[model samples]
Target chain A: MKLMRLLCWIMVFCIDVHVKAEETHKEKCDFNRGNCVILAEDGRRVFRSDEILVMLAPRALLEIRNENTVQLVKGDFYIETEQPVKLQTPYAKIWCEGECKGLFSRTAVTLEVKSLDGNWRITRAGEKTVYVVPAGLQVSIGEVAENGQAQMEFPQSLPWVPTIKQWASLYPGKVSEFKPELEKFRQVWREAVEAVSVLHQTVATRAVASHEAEVEQARRQRLAQLREDQGLRNLFRDKNP
Target chain B: MPLILYMRLTSFLCFILVMMLGWMQLYSRAREIFNGTSEIKAEIGHLKSTTAHERIAMALEREQFLEFRQNVATLMPDVLKSKGLGEEGYPYRSLASSISRSEAELVRQTIAKTLFERAKDNFRQEKFPKAIHGFHQIIDHFGFTPYVADSYFLLAESHFKQNELEACTGVIQEMVELFPHHELTGFALVRLGRIYQVQNRNEEAIEIFKTVMRSFPQRDVAAQAKASLKGIDL
Candidate 1:
């Protein structure tokens, strides 16, 4: 009787664990059809979950892995999230946090991540070092090098960002609702650029002041050493006489 | 002692009688259950056999019907011509009514398709008048076929090729009213706008081009409209 009771408890525990595991990772979207198009009313194929909102561009293939994770198989995607979300591409993985909005594009040879309004942490596949990309900057990870290294490019200012008018023109039917989101993106991008510029200026000013101080201290030390040398020469001359 | 033996014997006889009665009742119940099961099994067998036979018969019937449709389809054009029956004539109508509706539709589609091909060939050869006649015939008599939209568009093109701007516009407007959602409507609108441009009606042309661009944003229709707009701007 004791053995049977123990077995029953073990089975119950296993069933509880299985149910918890299932609850933790449930698929939010299943878009396996070729090059998913926007058949919904919004003129964009959007997948919304508790953690992130993903908008796929024309002919883009994307799959939501779970609530907070998405895989970009090909083409472009724009993502908005208040919480942390993981974006997986063929060449790299990007972790976005803190009310972030970003555009991610992948192709056969490269994966490009543009931080439109918030910070993004990017790590190339098989690489350990994470590169933090601030808003208004973009990064591209190219095909792996022949020597088994990621060809990670340095972050730079976003070359071109689509305007609200252009996006509205592309999806004319949903212009009313789309315009406000794009306007907010523009405002956030402008603030981020200004913030980055001020930070750069402050760091430059501090570096210049520290360099000047170091130069002044070195000159004074040289002058003191010269005086001591002159005094020692005079004492030697007197003793010789 | 004898009276005790007699009592024991009578008790044994009564017990035997009860055992026999119980066995008889049990046997009757078993026989009833077995008979009921066999009856159900026989009914199931009959249903299975009938279904199999019906399926075979249906397959053979479908094959024979397909053969008959093929023969009728091959002979339909000659029969119509020999009977001196036009497509919309009462005699042809009566003949079409004699066949199944699907078969009649198939015949109409074949005739319309052949007419459309001939008209397209004429248009390609720059025989505008002949092409217009053929397209008009298709539109008038075989309008129910799927080639009507193509016929209308080609008819307008024939008019445009002959520099008959008014006729071209009239045909295009009619087509738009008839087939509002057809893809060719966008192309026809672009053509109409081009005619307007040729007539030096810039404002009207621009409006038509803008309409095309707004209505068919992702298609070649929009691209052509954009090109026309650029030309006007220049």
Candidate 2:
């Protein structure tokens, strides 16, 4: 037992020493979550939690051991290092992993979709499949693909999830008298949906009517051509007599 | 004699071990130096490639500009004379055409840059209308540039500035729609919270702020957003 304890202490001491050594050479670059950026380093920047995104810069290594989800919106990025990263999420669609280096070169396009089930899959639609972001691992979707297959880049997590009562308290009048306000909102939404549907139908009807009119005009022109031909024949006969 | 020999052998072994350790350290240091040199070389190569491309592009632009200037100079006198007002009409017409074309191109580029600068200035000054106009001009005129995303964000900000809550929200919604993967996504979210705050929608503001803090804690704006969220009633 004494030997084992001593070995454990030595291990801890060695780890501390290694950490200090690493810190001596480590430099940090500032970045925002959910925003694409160029990482100005060779080594991968480690993301510490599932609630945050570590915007991977161009050619910068992204090391995510465990994260809830990673959203990729636009830009060209690569995960070229040999590090095993884990993803834990449901319904994620950003393509960011595997032996492939995802190259998204479109000006404004998406590259992947993320599921909530801890799966990060390739999603560049109608473009070369550059990277198959590894399954069950966090990914950085910075590449812009021509196709809009990239899942919406959402922040890894919401900072605070308020309870129903707490949410109600945030707004002075809206949440306090919640039921009526909700009903009113529902009524407004329904009206908006109905209005939009009606507008669409009206446009469709107009288009159909215009097409029918065009067809009718073509028929009338053909009939007029036939009548003109017959009139010329009759006039020729009278001239001959 | 045996005892002395044993002592000497022990001392020699110790020296050899120390020397081996020193040599290993030196080898590691040299390896590190080699790796750093290679990295620097790669960076320099990349920079050189980029510089070469930039130089070529600049040369092409300069050539085009010079050609246009010469054509206009040659045509101006002819047009004035042809006008029968003691001026060369043909040369002037040709000159005017060439100058007009160049001026049009210049205006397009200038308008884009001007809009970008104006938006930034208006944002700083809190002059929402001018900022919105500038951003709209960029979007309308320079949709092909990468600055279109920026214009969308700026337009959203303008709507927010005018106290058009729904309009601002709608514009931001469009921005997110158009450029879901843009670098300014986080900035747009931050602006959304600020708009909510102005309208006394403290809860919504707090929610958005919290989202920024939790999702983008590393962002510069996130730091301010986080601090603001803490002060909210929620």
Candidate 3:
């Protein structure tokens, strides 16, 4: 009898260990947002979009149309997946088929695949038409996305980030009374005041102008409805340049 | 008689031991079920709370961005027309450059502010090209000025108003990324989504709206995004 009781206790112990192991192996992602840091063997992905359906099981499947390689929905995503992260839309399927980092966005006319530091793929849905978008390059799919034009729009934008960095150099540290000859300090404070007061005055004037423009627009609409409208000619009063 | 009683007592003891063992197994199974259910429930509660928190924060951020834009729109004219400090005039940096270094800094600020306001006013009055030029001046020459963020946004807005969708997309993307965590970022993201919708890229629009709903679930923008999603065919 004692031997049988001991055997039953051992069985329960084994079952509990198996259950705990299963919980750890199965990846069940939380559907709610609050500083979610997606961790994989290789790297991490921080989500900033409002609507994303991320499933970690069976290869981290995001929402995509099953009928085609193309996705029915497209939102901005920054991915650094351990394996390749594939994005399917109705028009095309984009994947960092290579190991790397990238940000993908879709617009009204195009699926813009911006490979920040990796080689991404753009394959047309229902067809094997593929475009290899290399590192530091952008590829678009749609009416505006031509075969060769993607390479021409290089050095894509102004130095917005660098510009902010340079601006930060002007920041003056906290000034104490002992630090009297702080010319830069005084200067920073002065400009801040000037900015506030001048901006306030500008906003007030704009409000008044906006109100006046609205009244004028309404009056013009009334007149146009009564007579034969000449359109562009009516809105334009040519002034001396 | 004593031998018969001994056998019966032994059998009764064996039955009691078996029943106790069976009860232990049942209790263990019940405990496991109860623990697993509670764990799942705790997770669900955490997720619901987190989503609610995200929604409230997003709403507040969006409201703040709108308020700032409206005030700045009205303030543009006032800044442009402000008379320089009577004789302590800081018109262009050219005059201040000849003076002390500190004076030059003041002149630069004044000039950048003046240029930004003029460009913004031109935007309000529907003068797209000139507005673009003025905004670029603030970005190029006075990158350090407080006007940089506003200039970037207005520059994109000017392009958008001019029907330069391509340029608008790029600039708004730049704004959203370079100024992450700023209130303007929310507007930029939403505007980007709308641009996609207008261009008939409903799938992309849906994706954007979904992201907004997930990240800022409690916001009116999220609700608007839901409406947008429903309004779209898919």
Candidate 4:
């Protein structure tokens, strides 16, 4: 009886160890949002136009067909399509196997779908322009204007400029003591820019005047004085000549 | 008569022993079932809480980003006009460069705030992958912002949520390595030790929990760690 009880205890201990080992192994594979198991039935699952799929696979060529539209979030496998595909994102790089028909949001998230056929036309809103997306082209959202000009655009800049009051609060001084000096600096800067604008406008408007030479000379003189007042010695130092 | 009495006593003692052992086993089984059910419920609650928080946070971020875009759109035209350029002729590259550093600082703060919110919400939602992605985005885009330490904490939480407890160990391990003096370090360490406990890796859990108690004696996490150590029974 003693021997039988000891055997039973050993068996229980072994089972417990085995269960823990299994749990640990299960956790190992489920680490990377690998939680979802896509079954064969998922292939037939129809996703709606607004449904976005972020493919986790590094190298997957997903073949998705939609009657409406789809947005592929960043870090998804590229889509290869035979039909014209309309992709909307800040930008998209799609490869078309057949006719490429799609609209892209002109915002930074533009659709760049590649096509097997070299013939393609890009329409921004209503403006349609015939263009060739080479067999393996990667196009961004914006159009390269005529003359092959690329307009370099920056991302949205910052908002909420620190007011003089806001800046003063960071320091140990009272607002009354600080505001006047800051305001004076701002006013001086504004006046200096206005003086430059006035000179430029005068030069532009007097171009067809009979006293054009006189206007030009006066504009130069004014620019020189304005530059001096603003302590911009390099700007109009030679204008005295 | 003596033999009969001795036999009766022995039989009585045997019966009592069997009854006591049976009761002990029953009590142990009940305790095991209760503990197991409690853990399952706790996990379920964590998932539900995380989902709700994450949805709200992501929506908030998207709204804020859109607002930022609109504000920039409205202000850009004015800046372009001041520069003597029509919308088409705007020297965008130059104007962008001329934007003051303080302006960039403001944008960074907003982005950081949004990223942190998304990360924390995802962590709460038990969506570890999404939460990790959010933290990575914060680290990638808002690396210069004040959200770095918080991002690390969220990343650790994300890994923990997925039951990638081992993977989580490495992340929190890195967190401690990277942010040695971070205010939340003890909390993270205690949580990491709990992951070990959940896996029945009691020795490692006890070691780490003890370390937390020693290192962060004044912190509440340390107290929790001490309480957790009581369960290890070693």
Q: What CAPRI-style quality would you assign to candidate 3?
A: incorrect
- How does model 1 fare in lDDT? 0.70
Ordered list by lDDT, greatest first: 1, 3, 4, 2
Evaluation by TM-score, superior candidate among 2 and 4: 4
Alpha-carbon error at B28 in model 2, in Å?
99
The digit string of per-residue lDDT tens for model 4 on B1-234 reads 999898778666655665666667677768868779757877899997688557545643553453344334334545555663656554653444333234457766887898789778877877778889889898888877888888877787777767677777887888788877666778888887878878888889889988888777566777788888887875
For model 4, the DockQ equals 0.01
lDDT of 1 by residue, B73-146 (tens): 33455555667366556575455444334545777788899999999999999999999999999999997888
Write the residue-wise lDDT of candidate 1 on A1-241 in tens digits.
4544554554444342333332232233543332222222223456665676776666565545455556666666777778777776545778876877777777755788877667888877546788898877777886443223346875666654453333343432366777676777676667666776786788879999999999999999999999999999999999998
Per-prediction TM-score, please?
0.32, 0.27, 0.29, 0.30
lDDT of 2 by residue, B69-123 (tens): 4334434444455572534454444444444444345556766877798788988
True contacts kept of 3: 0.00
Give lDDT tens digits, candidate 3, residues A1-241.
Answer: 5755665665455443434343353334343323222322212223323233232211111332222122323334444433454565434656665465444554433455544444566665334656666544455554211121111121122122432232222212233531452343344334444554575688879999999999999999989876645554555644322
Candidate 2 lDDT at B203 equals 87
Q: Evaluate every candidate with DockQ and list the scores.
A: 0.00, 0.01, 0.01, 0.01
| Candidate 3 Cα RMSD (Å) | 29.5
For every model in order, the TM-score on chain A comes to 0.55, 0.31, 0.34, 0.27
True contacts kept of 4: 0.00
Off by over 4 Å in 2: A1-241, B1-107, B119-127, B197-203, B214-218
